[model samples]
Target: MHSKVLDRLLFKEDPVEKLQKETGKNVNDVHIDFNSGQTPQIPSQRYFQNSNIFINKHHRYSYMPAHTHDFIELNYMYSGHCRQYINDEPVALHAGNVILMDKDIVQKIDYVGESDILINILIKDDSILANVLNTLAQSTSLVTQFLVNASKVHAIHNNYILFDAQKNEVAQHLIDSLIIRGLGNDGSNAREVNLLLSLLLNELSHSIEAETHNFESGTDDLLQILQYIDQHFQTVSLAGIGRHFGYNSNYIGNKIKAETGFSFQSLVNRKRVSLAKQLLAETDYPIARIASEVGFSNASSLSKLFSKQIGYTPGVFRQRRHVLDVPRISRTLES
Candidate 1:
């Protein structure tokens, strides 16, 4: 039994379908002017307004070209089934399934019939997303951790997670609430929407049936390796991790590069640099000590890599961050 709101939104002949019926023109021939790139990049500004989140029904009866978007996208199979390709891999989604895609992933959708009701939920603002992730930081769910890592600006790869929520009543109900909140335009605040989204993700995180799909095989092993690196980056070694995972060092190294587009050492350095920045911003640790804590042999090594990665020395970064934080600290104290 569909909710009244879902029924109202699902069965309507949307304008795009109406235009296609009346003029016999496809959607691409109608109003969508894609970029001239080999894989057309869709800008978030095309769909986003003042809010960080936007929801819309997928236009039916058109062959969507292979394209990428600048924002995170989640597609919910509201009542029917559809098929799409992500990174040249075919994925079939049925009713009550959900697919969450990170930014810049190549995707294409097949033409759908009138019964297909796919809903698009675009997350346009990274800041808002970061806030949501922060609220879920304490979660130990692999899905939560994967999302946190994937959302980082320095993420090694773009990926997607598919949830089989067809029989999950909680997930379906939350999806309905999100659709209603997103489409009603009833003076609902962004915080409410964020909360609902947060709850939905948390629920999905706990769903044992949720499946993760990646562009390559051996993703489960890769995720395990990544998680191990994240936990022990300050002291992790390629040889040690290989031994731990029962693979040869050479094989592990090649697999890491093949799956993540980065070498094992590069991934470790990224993690160390990230921690170094945090220590510089929030603590009074000396540069040498911070370097040692983050796995650099000395301050000079950290400084060289920091300059290469961040365009400045650690001292300069710390001083700039302090200068930027003074006003905020003063306001906090006054309040």
Candidate 2:
């Protein structure tokens, strides 16, 4: 059943490809409106009217010109291989590889043949992205830290993260699941699509072959510091991290605030709260224990900060999650 669905979706010719074949013209020439702007910026409105996640197959047999868009783009090489020039740098993508391009990045694709299947997954919703980043706050991966920092500030532009997941069966499965879900109902299953995308990103964060390109100066040191904080947030201090990185506390503290718009303590508190929420939802741990486990002094401290940041106390949040999960548990037992 999965094979049939994959074959139909991957092999079938879309309307644009049909037009290209009939007229012997590239997608750019066929769609003159795309070239109206000086740099040819693809607006979110063109493909994202009712959905924050949009999935489309890249048009084949045409040279896609250098252009920018107003949304994050994930290009998955589903089959075969193709080359693209991102920021005038050559990037070759093979089957099972995924590349995430941030907004306003100039990208030009070489002509792709019929056997080469490239899938475009465009995300335009900042709230969804924020939720993903929050869920990943405990991750010590430099890639995750880079993403968190890049999203919070505008210092990095024309940036991209490449994941050479050609050997990662898990990543490939997640990518296929995202494509299948997105292509199924035209945004009717948007919640599921977003969840799959989040899972995919989390998987990519741990990928050993992940690489980030076109980052601004000082980003590497900052990302390393952020990773250290994530790894030691329970007992991390400004002075401690400063010594570890061979810088003074004041300089490191100001840099964190400048790049992420949050003070050092604030970032640590956010990570603690993120872990507290996870434990509350998934464990039977007591509120005080959960608080201490996540680096809080006591339950009150957790509640004060949690309520301020998440608009709910730990007890209330756990109860709400329990209420939401009861029905699903009941349905499973009934079956």
Candidate 3:
């Protein structure tokens, strides 16, 4: 059923490149020979920069350094087993199980046996969602950000795909169907692709809930505040946002201060300043432009607020960022 995947990985640019000085022997030099029929097709996004997936039935490889992706990820094990070093947590998963990875998750995967049979789905916040929604909604919902709201999140929400067997079976089939449809649906209905994506999102939401903390804040009000902060990061004002949400401005402000250990304005201001710091370090744009780019109406506002929070001007903040890279506190404790 997934012969297409086999063809795409072999004789193609192997994103799973073997390291020069890895502990195991070099596997890159060995050429794959398929004299009987076509190898198979892999997901096109698999070869895209910063994204790839392979279903390794009996493949083996040397270790790669711990790395991270700027996109959500999912891994399902069909057979065999492997140990994963996910940030500070090390976990082992066998067949019929899976893991949902947050975008900033840093981890390394190591197969325990001859080869690991697994399928990976990598979703970067790109046209992938837009193409699926086929609408102008560009994922601006606050409820779905903290919690997965299937309607907004799913490409096809009203229906679902059927697996009727293993957990691995459904995810694998759905991704494979999408890959084929993406290649050339020709003019056929996209029902197959739509159902596949919706089902995949459902599966992933389950995985996320299972792995993450079962968080239930004493009051839903705190969550509402978080949503408000996320939604209006650019032009969010503590008083205005609080009033708009139907609470007295001071009451809302006090609630935020008590629950989160920060005043309402402080939380939203931190968000803007934090984003500004990122743009400053990553881009070569001028300070005035960077300030305006990060939602400050004027450069003076960014400078004043940045100094209050970070104790440095934007220029000096960027300069000290490289020098003052904070050592991972947990690493120190672990050592």
Top-scoring candidate (TM-score): 2
Per-residue lDDT tens digits for candidate 1, residues 1-335, read 56776787777987888887676656773244565558877767756665667777887766577888877788989977899898888889898888888777899988777788899888764433233323444455655555545544455446788888778888888888888778633323444566677678878765544445443333446556766777677889989998999999999998877655567887777767767876787677788988998988899999999999879999998898777662212212111
How far residue 31's Cα lies from its native spot in candidate 3, in Å, is 21
Candidate 3 residues 46-128, lDDT tens each? 33442222222223454333555544455655556677766647767665556655544566666433345555544444323
Clashes of 2: 0
Flag regions of model 3 displaced more than 4 Å: 1-59, 112-114, 126-172, 175-195, 204-209, 213-335
Prediction 2 TM-score vs. true? 0.65
- Judged by whole-model lDDT over C-alpha atoms, candidate 1 comes out at 0.72
Query: At residue 311, what lDDT does model 2 achieve?
Result: 90
Error of 3 at 56 (Å): 9.6
C-alpha TM-scores of all predictions: 0.60, 0.65, 0.40
Evaluate residue 315 in candidate 3 and report its C-alpha lDDT on the 0 to 100 scale.
81
